[model samples]
Every structure is written in structure tokens, then in C-alpha cells.
Target: MSYRSWCLALGLCLINGPLLAIERAWPITEGMDVVGELSHAEAAYEDTLIDVARRHQVGFEAIRRANPEVNTWIPGEGTRILLPHKFILPDARRQDIVVNLPEMRLYYFPRDESRVMSYPVSIGRMDWGTPVGTLDVIEKRENPSWTPPDSVRKAYAERGEELPRVVPPGPDNPMGDYAIRLSRPSYLIHGTNWSTGIGMRSTHGCIRMDNDDIGELYSRVSLGTSVNIVNQPIKVGWRKGLLYLEAHPPLEELEDDAKGMDEAVAKVMDAVGERDARVDWSRVRSALNEVSGVPQVVGWEADQPLTTSTSATSSARAEPPAADP
Candidate 1:
């Protein structure tokens, strides 16, 4: 049967939501069809991307995939992201949507749900920040229009080039070929004129998925599907008897915050009183430097340093974007 026909046969259409727990590395089974989870939310923060992911217990890749449109290095102030803390696998015949804010990525759980596929994304920028709230897919379009927002028009007007109200869909169109309008006006899940900006922060206030990925998602989801937007900054886990932390601070935390990143790392270490712990200072420092917010750990640690693990029981899974020093 054809793809659409198959969907019709099952009466199962994919949907999006505001925030829902995401499944981790779930085992792919033949009979199980997993959709996005139904329970998860992002935290409010003004820190950088790395610090935000660390605090939220999610992977950097997951974050990147959820917010594909964000700039990786310079996310502006008050930018929010989705944190997948739990997994909601489908049961043999369902589909779901997953967005990880820190990594700025999105994953689509297909109807058959044999396996999950992820795509790079872009999210809100400094002034034209995206909102964090519950949303639904209200409409989907092919060859969508690129109506320039008034703010964008004003920007152009200042430059002596007054632009038209809309740009037609094509190579020059910012919306690319497909657009999924959200319940939130002026916001959408659409294609991009800027592709490298995928997996980074670069949009005014929309969830920018990859050209192909958005197309795949657009085809699967119907109007009125849920869409959840959020912001989280930290993700932690235990690996090999070590406590690992991954962080992505919000942009606001970097612009005006007075506390130095080095000092912040030292402070967190001091708080644990594990001064002698074998913490990777370089990793901590880089996260603070590159991500523009707080720092988080990506490996295990104790109040006291211990010998390296000798058994697999102590093994821990590293976050996808774990910075290697």
C-alpha cells in the first residue's frame, strides 16, 4: 500500500505536543511502534546551551536535533529549549514527535515506529526569540509562502530596501518548500534559506527543521497535532561509578552575568567538597566557554577520588555531544 494509504488504513496520524519525555536509546523491536512520549517539559533559564542541557538530564545531540535552527555557539538571551527526560516508546502502532532544545534537534517517531529518525533544527534567536509553550500543528503547506514579519521588514527598510510583504517559495524563499504552521501565530516548523544554521540558533521564532526532515514530518503529521516548546539547561547521568554532567547555559547568563566560568566550575566543585576529585577541568572550562552559560559534568565523580573502574557495571553512557578534551 502507498504511504498515505497505509496511514489511512491504520487511522493513525502522527502528532506533535508542547513538551513530552523522550525515549533514550530504546531497543528497536519489530512489533513495537513508538511515538514521542507524552510527558516532558523544559526548565526556564537564562544560561547557555551547554549548561541548559546538562541540568536537564538529556544528550547534547538530542537538544541539537530538537532545535535545529539555533546557532550552536552564540544563542541569544532568554532562548528556551526542550529537554527529554523520559522516553515514551510507541506500543506496536503509533507515532510521536521529539525535540531536544540544547542540541537543537528534532526526531520523528513514524507510525510503524520501527525506528526513530532524527534531524537537525534551528530555533529562536536573541531578539526574535521563540516562545516556550504548548502548541499544535494547525496547518501544513507545500511550497509555503515566506511572509516577512514586520520586524524583518523594518530591518530591511532601515537598509533602504523596503521588501514586499511575502517572498514566494523557491530557492530564495526562507520557508523553503514546506511549512507547518503551529497553533502559535507567526511561528512554524518550516524549511530554511540557511541550512548550516541547522543544529544551531538562527531563526526569529520558529522551529527550523532540515529541508528533508521537515518534509518527512510534514507528510506524517496532520493539522491539530500537538507541538511543545521549552528551554532546559542541564542533563546528568551516572557512568562507570562516575557521575557525569552535561550543560548548555542560556544566552542571557553569558551577556551580563558577572561570574566567570572558571569561577563557576570551581564553585560547583567546591560545593561538592570534592576538590580532589579527578574532574576534567578542560571539559568544564570549555563547556562554560563554548556554550555560554553554566557548566555540567559528563562523567562520574565522587566527593573523593577513586581508582578507575575495573568492571563494566560502572560504565556510563556519555551524552552525544560530550566534549572530548
Candidate 2:
């Protein structure tokens, strides 16, 4: 949809009123979570930032934030881009919530001693990228109500379709079955009538998850917990003395400029603060450049080799031995 249309339709969801306030997202941590090797430089044809990130398992936001110079339309061929592949796991401390922008995923870690559970989520579009800052879940409601903001209602009225001031819970309700209020005024992590949008950039600014996923998360998380939103993909891991790396593409919206293998590797390493981990820069560069999805160990001592595993679920788990660096 056009930017104007989006603004009109979802303006209420972005209202800035003095109501329940959710905490802002946290800052990016300079840690690593060992993904796998980076490829060397590669070329792109008919590539969008989102597709490139998906191909490389990176978040669109991380790739976009990393390379601000590359335009979305003309990310020239052999551009030698870096990918945020292996990244440090987000700091989901007590009541600390984390959102990995690159992976398009949200994780809820309870404050006390509750085991954390994560779910895939679709965030805002580039025009309305989800805001990042320290935030918290402020309120919760079952069978909640949705009150379309004034701006949204005005826009619709201009279109000759005046909508209701408030919507009750039902299948047609945009807020879905359950809603968790945020500290950021009107924003929320709630269910959606558009379940397909989960894991895709379709929301205005709120985080969207599958109905089941949200339900599961709702049961586990409570109000007053911390929420952290980040965009690190390529994470570095150190097992014993071996430095390991994993490279994935950014999220859908941030992959528009994903080219230049050397630069991409450097960006990923920089995200994790492990530029010195590259034993063979050339090999690492090549892997970042490669377009294939297969995992590869670009550089390491011949005897002190590294093991790599690539799977969405494997990476999602609390710990996976196969991914040890």
C-alpha cells in the first residue's frame, strides 16, 4: 500500500496520548552469538534488500542500518556487501525482552525465574519501522477493545468511510483476542486479523505474531517486564580458543543494499565487535560473497577447526550443541 494510505488506515494505532506507556527498546549490545562463516563478495540481479536478507538469513533492519549509503533501487552489482549473520544473543535478562530485527523474531524472557519462550514476528514496514528504545509491557487484556485514533478516523472519513470510534473483540477486531499494552502510548504486541503478516513487514509499528504464538507468549509474559529490540544477525561465538562466526542476511526491509562481500563481512564482525576473529580475511570475504545457503567455515586453524549448524529452530532454541563455535 502507498504511504499515504497506510497513514490513514493505521493512524489510530500510532496515537501518542497519555495512556498506558510501554517501555522503549534497549540499545544494541556489542556481543556475539556464533552463526556460521561469511562468504566472499557476490553479485546481485533483481535483488531487493528484504529478499537478500532472507536469502542470507539476516534481518532487513540490521542490513539497512549497517549500510546506509546503498540505495534500495540501485545496489550495484558486485557491491561487496556485509551480512549480519552470526550475532550475540540479545540480553533478555530478568524481565528483559529482546527482539532480533534481522531474524524478524521476538523473545519474551520472564523477570523472575520463568523459562523464556520466543516466537516469530512481523514488524513494521520501512516507512513505519518499529521504534527502538527501552520499553516494558504495561497492561494486558483479554477480549480487548480497539479504538481507532482520531487521525485514522479522519482519513477514513475523507475517503467517505467513517469507521467506529471503538471496535469490540471479534474475528474482525484488529487487536485480536488478547492485547498487551505498551509503555509507548498506544503501541502493542497483540493478535491480528491478518495472521499471514506474522514474520513479514506489514504492521504500522506494533509487533505482530501468529495467534497461537501470541497466546503462548501472553500466558508466559506479564506486565512491567523489560523489552529489548535489536537488529544483529551475523553473530560470533568463541568455544575454547576457536573463534567462530555465522553470517545471515538482514530482515526484509534492510537488505536493499546487501552487496560487497568484504564490506559485508566487516559489518557483521563489527556488529559483534570481533573483527580480529577472521583468521583468513580472503576466505571469510568469499563466503560473505557467496549466495548459496549452505553453511561454511571460511577461516580457522586447520587443526583447531570450527563446527557450524544452520536451522531456524536450532538457532531459536536456548542452546544447541551443533552451533557451538
Which residue segments of model 2 deviate by more than 4 Å? 1-88, 91-95, 112-116, 154-161, 238-325
TM-score of each: 0.52, 0.56
Model 1 steric clash total = 91
lDDT, candidates in the order shown:
0.53, 0.55
Reference-based lDDT, residue 206, model 2: 82
User: Model 2 scores what on Cα lDDT?
Assistant: 0.55
Q: Candidate 2: deviation at residue 201, Å? A: 0.8
Q: Residue 209: error of model 1 in Å?
A: 2.2
